[model samples]
Target: MPEMLIDYYKAIENSSAKMLEAARLKDWDEVVRCEGACAVLIEQLRYQSQQQELEPAQRKEKARIMQRILRNDAQIRVLAEPWLTQFEHLFEGQLQVMH
Candidate 1:
């Protein structure tokens, strides 16, 4: 059976939530994995959207899901900023060592 548009929204939301959880734990790998999943889901959602539109109720639900996803994303970014800065410094140090 073909996937429903609402299902895609739900899946993306789930991935986003997982990303937030992983970020809270400082598990960057898991966060990356979930981010990848969200990317794939969002791409699929875009394609599926062209082929099918959500019902009015589904559209409302999608809006709610999107809101949660955005909130999760904000939290993830806040948690990740410091880790990303540290990683960037480490990478720069490694490059200096090579030189």
Candidate 2:
């Protein structure tokens, strides 16, 4: 396909959407798994991007896909705040004990 680059972006977006759903469900393990998948997709996208360029129309579509991914990421972060705080506290406690 001429727009294989766009396909990569779409795949990343889909993974991000799944991550968002997992975050909503408070399924941290699932979110982590999805995050790993997203990292792989992002690496693949980066490699593919270096090898190919998107057409002007595909570039626009890519921008839209990126916006949605960012939106999903923002929401996921918001949802994870409580968990992050707890994790930070755990680390802080361990640090205090070590000291």
Candidate 3:
């Protein structure tokens, strides 16, 4: 809602896209870097979520935190889904090879 929150969401979305691209390319190093960035953002979001009282100034900060969390989650799922899919494909290929 707040501009700050919108910024965080944008950052998360960008980072997630990078991570997904890295995974899709099988670039483990890039994936790790993206994952680390996501972890830091997630921590910041968790801290903001714990604050009980938010002032008007803090509203943007809180919104940014929430956005970061949501985007991070979506990014993680994106990264994981491809990995799972790839693994299944590889496993099936191995099975066929064995046969």
Candidate 4:
């Protein structure tokens, strides 16, 4: 069978879930990997959307999936904030050392 637009939404949601899980585990590398997957999926989705569109029911499901993805992304940001801050500080130190 051919692929569907809803399937892309589901795959993106799944990737976001994985990203949240990896973030919770403090595995930033895995989170980054999942993020890359999400990015590729998003691009694929954009391309596929031009060719296919969801039915009314599928559109509803897509909305719900998007909500969940947003939730997962919010949680991931919350989990990664401290680490990002520290990473920024590390870069700052490097810049200082270079000067």
Candidate 5:
């Protein structure tokens, strides 16, 4: 059971890593695709979590995996900031023309 939980976390970490790579490459579409995959994994993890508990050692490992996932997410957000700003500007311009 603990191993299964760890596997889920590992899969999420892999998805996050892929997302980070896509961000680094400036491939927003690929990043979004990986984000969707991560979301599904997260949902599955949530359901599995309610049905099982991790042992102490596995808990520590899970914490480490979560930390890496968070770091990847943070970097992805940073990479996205400029693109988001540009998208917002485009929307603002459209709004002004429509008014």
Candidate 6:
């Protein structure tokens, strides 16, 4: 596989680990944040894969796609914290009731 592909996969793996850890700790916020980060990374990888077939003349178009991917990733990361926090609270409440 290409170096880019490897790197992308590594990012996803790392993000998944983090998310799992957060879930184990019942840290809903962290889990959500990590998951969001993973999602963005995956989307970026998807975009990059699509650009791999483009011709040299389409460099600008590829750049635009990359830019959009990056922007979406950033946006997701920004919202991750709050979403995770909310998720954690809900999860905790449910767990408490189960006891």
The most accurate candidate by TM-score is 4
TM-score of 4: 0.93
lDDT of each: 0.91, 0.92, 0.67, 0.93, 0.93, 0.66
lDDT of 5 at 64: 98
Candidate 3 Cα deviation (angstroms), residue 35: 0.5
RMSD of each: 2.1, 2.0, 6.7, 1.7, 2.3, 11.2
Off by over 4 Å in 1: 93-99
- Give the Cα RMSD of candidate 1: 2.1
**Model 3: per-residue lDDT, tens digit, 30-65?**
978997987776566556546544567657765765
**TM-score of each predicted structure versus truth:** 0.88, 0.92, 0.47, 0.93, 0.91, 0.49
Query: Candidate 3, TM-score vs. the true structure?
Result: 0.47
Q: At residue 23, give the lDDT of candidate 3.
A: 71
Winner on TM-score between 3 and 5 is 5
Residue 34 lDDT in candidate 3? 93
Clashing residue pairs, backbone N/CA/C < 3 A, model 4? none
Q: Per-residue alpha-carbon lDDT of model 4 for 1-99, expressed as tens digits?
A: 128889999999999999999999999999999999988998999999999979999989999999999999999999999999999998997899899
Query: Comparing candidate 1 with candidate 4, which one achieves the higher TM-score?
Result: 4
State residue 43's C-alpha deviation in candidate 2, in Å: 0.8
TM-score of 6: 0.49
Tens digits of lDDT, candidate 6, 59-91: 555465556546544645554557667869989
Q: Clashes in model 1: which pairs?
A: none
Write down the TM-score for model 5. 0.91
**What is the Cα root-mean-square deviation between model 4 and the actual structure?**
1.7
Over 7-37, each residue of candidate 1 has an lDDT whose tens digit, in order, gives: 9999998899999999999999999999898
